[model samples]
Target: MKLKDLAHSRTGDKGDIINISVIAYNEKDYPTLEKLVTVEAVKKFLGETVQGEVIRYEVPNLGAMNFVMQKALRGGVTRSLRLDKHGKSLSSILLEMPLEINN
Candidate 1:
């Protein structure tokens, strides 16, 4: 599924929270994310890169998952002075992630 679809799946408009959806193209990619991007890993990634609490959830319908991050933008605005807080770049980072799954 596309990121737009994923974002739409997240039904929240608090502005403080940002949710991203991701889907793996194959089985190999699936396992990589499971092994690499754990809850703590996601938290650390978002915490350092963003200014909020990151929460990730698995969704079977889309063969993907959702990441609901809080306070990602500094000053609670899309354009934060913080150099590291650009949510648009998250798509690139997530694309690099491979999802890990086990039989």
Candidate 2:
């Protein structure tokens, strides 16, 4: 379902980009997770509350999904030092996403 339920997240904000990697415990569910963790879907979840360009990468080996959010940090490093805090919340937020599988 949610990213937190499925895996752990590591987030980094550098310059204007926010990078998040979600690692799943059960690697077998990667395919299904990938389907639900699409760039567009993540973008929708983040919404206008934040601004960024989202890119998703599949790491089947690690059973992880990496999301690169561009320009998410509005004020850059100096103005907003909230990257770590935001990252923590993002991990949990991602975990809450529901997964769908087609048989």
Instruction: Report the number of clashing residue pairs per model.
Output: 10, 8
lDDT of 1 by residue, 49-97 (tens): 5566677787655556777777765654455675544455665555443
Worst 10 residues of 2 by lDDT: 83-92
Model 2 Cα lDDT, one tens digit per residue, 1-103: 4566667777777776778887877887677777777898788877763586688888788888889887676655556667553454666665666665457
Estimate the TM-score of every prediction.
Answer: 0.58, 0.79
Note the residue pairs that clash in candidate 2: 1-97, 2-95, 2-96, 2-97, 3-94, 3-95, 3-96, 4-95
Displacement of residue 55 (Cα, Å) in model 1 is: 1.4
Model 1 residue 3 lDDT?
24
lDDT of 2 at 42: 81
Candidate 2 is scored at a TM of: 0.79
Clash count (model 1, backbone only)? 10
